[model samples]
Every structure is written in C-alpha cells, then in structure tokens.
Target chain A: MSWLWGAVIFWLAAWAFNVWLANRPVARSRAVQLFIPALFGVTLLILWEGIVRGLDVPGVILPAPSAIWATIRASLPVLAGDFVQTILKGALSGYLIGCGAAVLTAIAIDRSPFLQRGLLPIGNFVAALPIVGIAPILVMWFGFDWQSKAAVVVVMVFFPVLVNTVAGLAASERMQRDLMATWGASYWQTLVKLRLPAAMPFIFNGLKIATTLALIGAIVAEFFGSPTRGMGFRISTAVGQLSLDMVWAEIAVAALAGSAFYGVVALIEKGVTFWHPSQRGRT
Target chain B: MKDTAGIATPVIEAKGMGLTFETNDGPVHALKDVNLTVGKGEFVSFIGPSGCGKTTFLRAIAALEHPTEGTLTVNGMTPDAARQARAYGYVFQAAGLYPWRTIAGNIRLPLEIMGFSRDEQEERVERVLALVDLDGFGRKFPWQLSGGMQQRASIARALAFDADILLMDEPFGALDEIVRDRLNEEVLKLWARTEKTIGFVTHSIPEAVYLSTRIVVMSPRPGRITDVIESPLPKDRPLDIRDSPEFIAIAHRVREGLRAGHGDEV
Candidate 1:
C-alpha cells in the first residue's frame, strides 16, 4: 500500500477505538476519568507519529513526537535555561506588572466616574493595538532583554483584566447596596466590605486571561530581539537550522507552562470568589 | 407589654412622607403623604397589594431609602441617626444570604460589621440560630438548605445585633402555609421574649393579624396608608391564636382598609 493508504487505515482504526471507549460508562475513580483524556492524547501522538513516518514527509512539515522527545532529552539544559529566562524572568514578571496595573486601574475606575469615562476608551485602544506592533517598540525601549519581553506582556494583558474587573465592581445589585446604606456604612467600609468582595470574581477573570497573554507576549516579544537563550530565539534559530524537533520541544514547554499558570489563577479564583456562579459551574 | 393605646409619645412617627422619581416618561410618585405611627414595642403589620409602599414605608423607616418629603422619627431620632445607633434589624423579601458563607457565617455578618468581638459574634450567632430553631446547621451553605431554612438564617442575621426594632418586608410571604404558621408562632414567641418593636410588611391577611399588635393597611400607585387598626390580641400570642374570632375581625378590617386605599385619588 501507498504511505497515504497506511495513514488512512491507522487514522480510521484510532477514531473507531476512541468512539468505542467514549461509549463505555464513566469510571468509578477520579484517576480513571483523568486517565481517559491522557490515553486519548497518547493515542493522538501515536497516530501522528505513524502517519508522519509512513508518508515519508520531511521533518520541516511535521516532526514525529519521538523525534521531538529525543530533541528535548538531548537539550535539557538548553530547554531549562530558556524556560527559566522566558517564563520565570519574562512572563511571570510581566504577568505581575500587567495584572497589578489592571487591578489598580480597575479600582480607580470603579471609584471615580471620571476615570471610567476617560480610561476605558484608552484601554479599548490598547487592546486594539496588536502585539506585532508593540513588541518591536517595547524591545527598542526596554533593550533586548527579558525586561523588553515583560514590557510587551504588560501591553498585551492590561485591558481584558481592567474591563472584566470594572464590570464585576458594577455587578452588586441595588438591594445589596441598600443593605450597606441601611447599616450607615462609610464609603471606605462599603467599598472594603462589599464592593471589593463582590468584584473579586471579575478581577480574577482578568488575571487568569492575562496569564496566557503574558506567556505569548514574553515568547513573541523575544522573537523581535533577545539574547540567544530564550524560547522564541531558540525556536527561530532551530527553524533556520532545519531542526523542527527543537521547535516542537519549545512549544511543548510553552503549553505546559501556560496551562500551569492558568490553572493556578483559576484555583485562586475558586478560593477568593467561590460565591460566583462561574465558580459554582466547576462543581 | 403595655397595650400602649393612645400613648403620650409614639415610638415611631412619620408625617407627610413622600418619595418621587423622575423617569424618562415623567415623574413617578412612588409614595405620597404616608403618615403613620407605632407605639413602643408595637407589632405593626403593613398589609397591601403588590406595588403598595408597605415595603417602601418600612425601608424609609429603616433608612434604606429617603422619603422626598417627610419628618420621621424612630426611637426619637432621625432615621439616619437610628440606623447609626443600630436601632433596627431588617429582613428583606429574599433571604439575601451571601453564597460564599456558611449559615453560621451569614448569621455572624451583621455582628462582624457592627464591630462586635469574635466571642460576642459567636455567642449571638448561636443564640439567634437556636431562636430560629436551627440548632445544628451552622456549617451548611445556603444552597444546602431549603428556602425556609435560608430565610431563618437571614432572620438570625437580622436579629444578631439585638436591635430594638425589626423591619421585615414580606419575610414569610414566600413560604408554604405550614412553614409560615410555624415561623409566625416562633416570631411571636421571640417578640414576647425580647419586646422588640417589629414593623412587618406582608400581603397575607392572616399573617398580618396573627402576629401583629397593630395592622397598617396600605394602597399602591403613589402608595399611601389607608388605615391603622389596633390588634385585640394580647402580648402572649400562640399558634392556636390563628383560629380566634378576634384575628378574623382584624384581618377583615385590614382587607377593607386595603380596598379603600386602592383607586383613591392622590
């Protein structure tokens, strides 16, 4: 059979197996339920691996998972160095700055009507400004270091968090406010006791959304200009050298890190704003 | 408790109280010329049709709202002053329990806000929870309990501060008759024990007559009070009081007053 025929047979068999497994009743244990998705993921990798080799496709078009894993194994120190430089130094710092600025801005916007009218338009403008444009400017301003990557992340993440938090602050209904009023609560007391607590779910939403944006910004901004140690720089250089497996390894690291960051924010959100319906949907 | 008929001074008095709002269409007169008085420790039930300002009148007294034009006094002070002094506790139509907190936590909220010590909050929360006959459901979330239990938790929240007055807006109107009757009896018992002046708003005629020392009948659409009938019931009312002829008579008078208030020109 031709390589395309072989690929088709494997794909069909895998699809049939997945459908059969999905039809069975859910497992009694939480571990088993989690394992099902992992099983499917491994099967997908196997299918991808079989098809790529069977077709005699060039490495540039698609590298097999084993080749990617082998590249990761061969370059652990390089991968670790990039992970530390891009994620810890660049993304984490940017996430803190961007989310911090957004929250302070949101609190200010929530406090004064004047800022809400003046600043939200500016945020909308910032949100519209593409990272492709800002990354180069940030690189120029902050120099070709992790600082520049962090600056790029600040630009990418500031708006979504601000807007969501502003909306959350406005979410307290009339009766709730009236309850505070009847208690003769002072402005600071009302804000600290009621509005801030009420606004938490929205604030965390912005934080969670900003995590991925921070990662993307840190990685993409590095592509504009950076020392040779970062993920974006490595991936670009690897691509130039036709080492496609290295690019895949870097991408895997990014996916894992981004998901972990997002998960942490979501977990904190569950703790802080457990009252919200979005949190209720988790159970 | 004294009958307090034609007392020398009213514990609460509202004179020419009115509230108006300007909508896009025109002015909306929500309340107009609402005059009322309650003697010390009186249980005044405000009975009216929906949209009547029974709840609004209660809110105005609680200072949750400001009447456009009125001179009002509760405990011989302005509504704002009274609210600052923690003169009254209010139970809203909805239980309005915070979803984040457990039942005991919800009960402790008012005490916490009022700057009571932690020990005081715990003590009062326990006392009020038992007062509402919820002895052991403290750790449960609001969603875990039925609607009646949630409302009881809210009532416990309102009562935790030991306010001299209780403002209840349709507090038991949501419950089934069986639960309503049980709660009604419990309220009377609490009133007897504490002598708290309760201003209750409800649409149920029997509920109004069964628990109140007075019934303030209200009208809607530019809401105003139509009548204030004194209840003939003694201070120590019980569950069986609902079957009394005196309760029926007061309910009849409240119904008549409600009808008379409706369709009356401003």
Candidate 2:
C-alpha cells in the first residue's frame, strides 16, 4: 500500500514538474526538447515498477519493467542473434528487393495503359490476402528459414510501393510535361529527369509505410515456421515456458527496432525532399 | 533558298485553323478559322477575354494542341515536326520551375535534354541567369525566390536553349501590377538582345500595345480573331512611351476590337 501511494505522489509531482518545465523559456532549447520525453519515459517506468511490486502481481502474467530490463541484459547474445536473423536478414532484404522491384515495375507499366489497368488491380488483390493464409504456404515453398520470412515480408510490402510509385510517376504537372515536349525531350530523358524526381515524395511515403509492414510481416511469418532462433520463435517459446519477462524483452526490442527503422527512413526523406514545402523551414 | 526576295521568311504560319475539344458537353470550339503569320524577329501579341483561344493558338504553335481543321506550320514544317526539331521555347502563365531544382538547375534542364556539352550547359545557364538579372540567385531553390523572381528564372530557362522562337502564354498574368510592369520592360530588353521571334498572349490591352509589333485581338464563343492591328510604335520604346499619342491610339483600337466582339455576343 505504501508503495502504491508513493508511486501516486511521485507521478503527480513529476507531472507538475513537466508542466512547469514546459512553460519555462528554456523548454525550446535542444537539450530540454530531448529531456522532456526522456523524463516522461522514466516516470512511466517508475510508476510501472512501483505498481507491479505493490500489487505483487504474478510474473507469469505480467513482469515488472525492471524484470524485463534484467532479462534483456541477461539474454544479450540471444537477443542479438534474434535481431540479426529476423530484422536484418529477413526484413531489410525484403524491403530492398520489394521497393526496388515495385519502382521498376511502375516505370515499365507507366507506358502501357493496358498493363496499368490490368496490373494495379492484381496488386491490390495480392495486398488484400490474409498473411496467415500465405505465410505457411511460403514457409513450405522456401523451407523453414529466414528466406520464408523474407518472402512473406516481400508480399506484404510490394503493393504499397507499386501503387505509390505509379501515382508518383503521374505526379508531374501537364505544363511541366509540355515544357519537356517543347524541348524535344526523349521519353527516357523525361522519365530520368522529371518524373522520377517528382515521384520521390510519394515513393518515400510508400517506403516509410513499408518499413513497419516489413518488420511486422517478418516477425509474424516466423510464427508459422522459423529456424528456432528468431524474435518471434523466442517470444512464442518463452510464453509457453511462462517466462513473461522474456516476452516483454522481445516486445521492447521490436518496439525499439521498429522506431529506429522508421526514424532512419524519415531522416532520409527529410534529406531527399528538403525542398518540399512540408520539409522546409526547420533548424 | 526559300527566300526568293528580301522578305524575311515567316517563322510561324496558320491558315483557317480550327480546334474543337470533344467533351461530355459536346464539341467546344476553342479556336476557329484563325489565320495569322508571325515573321522572323517579330513580337506578336494575342489578347482577349477568358475562353478567347489566345492560349489555344499559342499551344497549337508549340504542338501541344492539334487543329482539327486547316493547316499550321512552324519554320515551313508541321508544328509537330518543328517541335521535334526543338525550334521554340515556351513559357507558361505560371513559373513552372521544378521545386527540387535550383534556379540554375532549372535553366540547365532543357540544355541537358538537348544534349549540350558540359561546358556549354554551364556557360548558357550563366548567360541566361545574367540576361534575366537573376545572376546571384542561381543556387537558390524556386520557392526561396519571390514570385516575380521565379517567373524570371523560368524566362531564363526558356532563353538558355537559345531557340529562335519564344512562345509565352500570359507569363506575367499571375504577378502584381508593379512586377508585371517591370517584367514587361525586361522582356522588351530581352527581345531586343536575342531578336527571337516572339508570340506573347495577354488579357491586358496596355501589355499588347507596349510589347508587340502586331496585336491580334480575339473574342470568345467559337473563339476567332476580331481584328489585327499593326503597331507603328518604333522598336526603341521607353516606359514613358505609354503616355504618347501613338501608344494610346493602338490601345484604344485594341479595346474597340474587344468591345465589338463582346457586342456581337450580347
């Protein structure tokens, strides 16, 4: 009871301090900008730790943040292996292949009205298929390894990038196209110089969306069948063994990896599209 | 060889030209029975109200639009063939500069497409940037510049290729009055320097009178030319030339021609 009350008091005090800090002129500074979110995260951890200990909750159901942290530290090597197997080998490779193929297909189909009409609907249908339905089939075809997981990820990411890139290729204005025509620009030249650059904003939108899907597909597909070493495999086994801390640790890793993936793409987007109105006027 | 006499060969020629757009509302006559000739080194203006097909005519010359009836030619070849030959540079109502590129890069775009050498591309970009008085703004993105400056950058882009014909469709229409006036002055100077055959479209009577050696007055509703007035204004025009009697007379005749077109509609 004292632990619960102590947590409540601390939460209110921290909340008040954050509000005061937010109102201060220094809040706009870069250090304070970073500090506020870090502080809020710490406060949540503290509250979770206090509440779990105070309630004396069973570890099999829910582990404390500290327990999860401890498990993460203890299983560093295992976690690193899982990270490499699932994220790096499966998700990253699929993302590169899927995005590359989609962009190429978009350009190829752009010249043909027949293919654009025929292919886009097929892509949409593929995108709509249930992941569970396809995962096991892919696992059988590709065998029980990271390859199957990558195949699932490729299926999940292809449609968005294809649709976005096609839409992006058509994004150049009619006047701009007319100017190209006046200059007697070859179709290849126009595609390389104008259409490709114009399509970048839309392509990045698709790419950013694909990063999250890539990770989720890779992890979830591992559930159908994996080589007994991925994050998904570890998570399932740990759950069956009633080590909730290990499951929480994997969740933490997934969350961090997902965020870092998204952040890197968004940073690249900012760099590539610095001239865009949405990206301009920042420090 | 085509010039049997001393008469300068016409750069653009149209005879009984008509363009009809097939829309859901049935065929709309955008241009009809339009006959005009723009000679080499001539500055011609097409002026009228909205839907008068002034822009349509310009687009036809650029081969961006095709005439359903009659003939149109640029430099003695078909408009399409002339476009293929890269005989002209076109400027739109808006600047239409690529947002991702700097001003200099935008100017270099046509040069790159036309397969100019690296040294030549750099040289032409510099020349046009200076010609449009946007010299120091070469590295700035389109959005970083003022609207007037962006329009000038676009002009520089059109000038970079040094095409013999410059087709402008109300290029300064979106700008404010003061910017428009300043741009008008600069355009005259540019025309003087380059001596390119120019076809300018505008809605303003003063703009037509000030810029053109000939003004083609047009009207809407099965858009056709109402009158064609030859300007007697000398080649060397100062800003104050607008106050002169000759300038006002040409402006008044253009106004009357426009009003007569409207009078027929009413």
Candidate topping lDDT: 2
lDDT of 1 at B253: 80
Model 2 C-alpha lDDT per residue in residues A1-283, reported as the tens digit of each score: 8887888789899899999999999999999999989889988988988898899989987789999999999999999999999999999998998989889889888989899889899989999999999999999999989999889999999999999999999999999999999999989999999999899899999999999999999999989988979999999899889998999999999999999999999999999888777789773
For model 1 the TM-score comes to: 0.94
Worst 10 residues of 1 chain A by lDDT: A1-10
Q: What is the lDDT of residue A153 in candidate 2?
A: 90
Give DockQ for candidates 1 onward, in order: 0.57, 0.87
How many pairs collide in each candidate, listed in order?
0, 0
TM-score for chain A in each prediction? 0.92, 0.98
Best by TM-score: 2
TM-score of each: 0.94, 0.97
Among these predictions, the greatest DockQ belongs to 2
* DockQ of candidate 1 compared with the true complex: 0.57
Candidate 2 chain B, run of 10 with poorest lDDT:
B1-10
